[model samples]
Target: MNNHLSKTIKNEMFSHHYQLLYNLNDFKPFGVEILFRSSLFSNPQRAFQKAKELNKLYELETTSISKAITDIHLNSIQGQIPDHLFINVYPSTLIHDDFVKTMKNLIEQTSISASNIVFEINEEELITDHYSLHNAASNLKEEGFHIAVDDFGKGYGSIQTVIEIEPSYIKMDKFFADEIEYSTHKQEMLKSMVTYCEKIKSNIVLEGIETPEQFFKARELGIKLGQGFLLARPCPLEDL
Candidate 1:
C-alpha cells in the first residue's frame, strides 16, 4: 500500500469521546467537548507521544478534528450534536504550518459553521512574540473559529494567557473542585475568577464537579458553565 493509505489507516484507528458542557442557570445543554481516544493505545496522550516520535503529530490532531465532524453522523446515536464543539488540541497544533487552511478545508466539507467549532488549547508552552499564540488565535478568529484556554489555574497555562488570548472560555482545572464545599479559599478564588471572566467577556467552565456540594458551590460562585461526573460523564459520541 502507498504511504497515504498507510497514514489514513493509522488515523482511522483513532476515535473520540464526548462530554457535555451545560448551562448552570437552566440545567440545559450548552455544548460538548470532544476528547480523542485511540483503540491502539489505552491512553490518548501516549498516542500523541507516539505520533510525535514519528513526526506525525499534526496528522493525529487533524484526523481527530475530522472524525469529530462525522462522529454522530456515522454513529447509531440518535441525539443531535450540540452546536458548540469544544475540541481539545495541543498548543503546538494551533501553531502548525498551514493549520488554518487545513482546518478550513475539513470544516468546509461539513454543514456546521466554523463559528460553532471552538479549539480548546491545552498543555503548556512558552509564549513568545505576537506571532505565536496570538497569531494562531487571530487566524482562527478571522475565519470565525473560537479559542478556549484549558486547565486555567493549574498546569503551565496562566492568568496571563487568559488576558492575552481572551479566549471565549476558561476551563478551570478540577483541582479546585476537589473539596470546594469546605474550602472558603477556593470559593473565594472562584468568585474572583467569575468576576474576572465577566470583565473579559469569557465564560468560566468549572470542571470536575463530582458531588452535590461541589456543584452547588460552583453554582453559588456565579459559574456560568460546568462539566463533571455530577452533570454527566464522558462517553463515546456513539453512546449519546
Candidate 2:
C-alpha cells in the first residue's frame, strides 16, 4: 500500500458503502450488501486485509456493523429499508463471545428488526472449531436473524460448514462467475451447486457478475439473486 493509503487505513477513514443485490427474475432490489470504502483505496478489501494483519479485524467489523445499523435506521425513517440488509462477518468474529451480545444490543438500541438483518459469514477464513461456529450461528438464527455462507466454494469446508450451520443463503463464489460464458466446465459446476442448494432448500446469490453474459448465464443456471457491477455498484447510502 502507498503511504497515504496506509495512513487512511490506520486512521479508519472508511465509510459504509452499499451494493444492491437484485432479484434476477424481476430485477428488483432484494437486499443491500454493506461494504466499507475509503477515498484512499479503490476497494475496501485491501484495507480489510491490512486490518486483519494488524489484529484489528474484530474492531473494524464491529465498527462497520454499528455504522451499517445506523444507516439502516436512518433509511427506515424514510421508509427506504430494503427487503434485507446483508452484513459480512468473519467466522472468528462470530465465535467471539462479545459478538452476539454486542449485535443484539445494537439491534435493540437501533430499533431495527432482527429478521431484516442477514449476517453473511465470509467463508474465506479458516474455521478451527465447527462446534463453536455452529453454536454462534444457532444463537443468531434463534434470534430470527438470517445467516448466509458467503464465497461458498472458495472457502474451507464449504459443504461441511453449510451442512453444520445450515445457512439460509449460499453465495456462489466469484471465481465461478468470472468468464463463465466461455467455460463449459464452470457452467456445469454452477448448475450442480444450484441443484445442491435446491436440495438443501437454501437460496443462492451469484456474486461479482460484471457482464451481461455472466448475468444471463446465472439466470439460466436458475440463480434468483445476484450482485455485481452489471447490476449495481457500491455506493454511499445517500445514493440509494
Candidate 3:
C-alpha cells in the first residue's frame, strides 16, 4: 500500500477536491475544505493509517499539502477560486520540527498568503505533548494562518486544547449533528456551544449536515457555516 501510495503521490495520481462550505445565513459559497482523493483507495483514511504505521506520515502529508497549495494558488490566479481553502492537518505533523520551515518555503514559492489557508487541526490522535502543540499552533497563527480545531469536544484535551490554541474556528463533531433536530437536549447543547463560540469570536461550523431539516435548524439556531453532502460532496476542483 505504501508503494502504491508513493506512486500515486509521485505521479500525481491523486486529485484534490473541494467540499463546498455554505453560509447558512444565505447559502452562499463561503469557502471550500480541500480534500484528497485517489482511485487506488476507496477510503483515504486507510491509506493515512498505513502511512502512519510505516512512519512516512510526514512525507505523505507534506507532499499532498504542498501540491494542494500550489494547485489552489494557480487556480485562484486563473479565476478558479471561489473562496478560502481549508486543508485538514494532523497535530503531530504541525508540531514536527521541520513543519514551519516546509510551510514557509511553500508560501514563498507560491506567493500565497497564510491568510488564504485555514489549517484544520485533526484531533483524532491522543495528544502526548500539549506544550509543543501549543507552541507550534501559536507559531502558525503568528505566521498568519488561521487555525481551526476539528472534533472539538470528542477528543483528548478537548477543553484544554480549545483554551490553549483559541482556534479561529470550532468544528463540532458530527455526533452532535445526528438527528439534532429531534433532541431538545442536543439543541440546548448546541446553543450553549454556539454562545461560547460567539463570545470568543471563533466561528462555529456544524459538520455532517445531510438534510434540509438539520440545515434549517442549524441556521435557525444561529450557525453561520455548514458542510455536508446536501451542500456538496468531494469532487474534482473543475466540477465546482
Candidate 4:
C-alpha cells in the first residue's frame, strides 16, 4: 500500500475502534480505552506490535490519544461521559519531548480536565532512563493528570518504580489474580501490595478478572477498582 492510502486506512480504523471501561463496585460505566483493530489484526495487542515493528508506534499512540479525547467529548455531548478515560501509553512514548505538550493541547481542544484522564503506562518494557521517565511522569502529575502503572508486578523493580513515579494508581497484574483462591503466595503478595499502596495512598486496580470467584477474591483483598470480563467487557462508546 502507498503512504497516502495507508494513512487514510489507519485514520478510518482509529475512528471506528475503541473500548469502554467499567467500575467493578456497581458495574457502572467508568471510562473508555482506545483500541486499534482491522481485518489484518484480531486485537489491539497484535496491531500495536505491528506498529512497533514498523517504527510507527509513536504515531499510533498520538492518533489513539486524539481519537479518544474526541470520542469522550462526543459522549459528553450525549450525556454519556464517564469518570475517567484510561489511555495505554508506552513508557518510551510518554518520555518524548513533545508528548506532554501534545496532551496539553488535546485537553485544551476538547475542554477535558486533565484529572479525568489517566495515562496507563505499560511497565513491561524496560525503562533504562529512570530520570526521563520520572521527569515525564512528574510533569503529567503537575498538570493534574493521573498516572497509573499497568501490569505492575510483572515488570522489573516494579515496587521501586512505583516509588519513583508515585503513580496515582497501580494496576495489579493478572498473573497474581489467576488462581488466588488456591495460591497462598499470590494472596500474600497481593495483601502485601495492598498494604504498600495504603502507605503511599495509591489506588489499586486489578485487571483481567474473568470469574465470579476472581472478582470476589479481589474484593476480599480490598481492591476497589477492577477491569475484567466478569465485571465488564470492552465495548464501543455507543454500546456503553
Instruction: After the best TM-score superposition of candidate 2, give how far the Cα of residue 135 lies from its true spot, in angstroms.
Output: 0.7
Model 2 error, position 1 (Å): 13
Model 1 alpha-carbon drift over 4 Å, by segment: 1-11, 73-79, 124-130
Candidate 3 TM-score, C-alpha based: 0.94
TM-scores across all candidates?
0.90, 0.90, 0.94, 0.90
State the lDDT of candidate 3 residue by residue for 1-240, as single tens digits: 668867876787777788898999988988899887767877777667777887877888888899988887787787667556788888889899999889988988875788888888888877888899899999999998888988777877778888898999888888878898898887898899899998998999999999999998998888899988898888877777
Q: List candidate 4 stretches off by more than 4 Å.
A: 1-10, 15-32
Candidate number that wins on lDDT, 2 or 3: 2
Task: Give the Cα-based TM-score of candidate 1 against the true structure.
Answer: 0.90
Ranking by lDDT: 2, 3, 1, 4
Find the 10 residues in a row with the least total lDDT in model 2.
Answer: 1-10
Error of 2 at 178 (Å): 1.9
lDDT for model 1, on a 0 to 1 scale? Answer: 0.80
**Which 10-residue span in candidate 4 carries the lowest summed lDDT?**
1-10
Give stretches of model 3 more than 4 Å off.
none
Residue 79 accuracy (lDDT) in model 1? 44
List, residue by residue over 1-240, the lDDT tens digit for candidate 1: 235434644649766788998888899989988887766676888767667667777877887788778665444245466878898777778888688998898777766778889998875544444358778888899999999988888857477777778899999999988899999998999999999889988899999989999887888889979999888888977565
Candidate 2: where are CA atoms >4 Å away?
A: 1-12, 39-43
lDDT: which candidate is best? 2
**lDDT per model vs. reference:** 0.80, 0.86, 0.84, 0.78
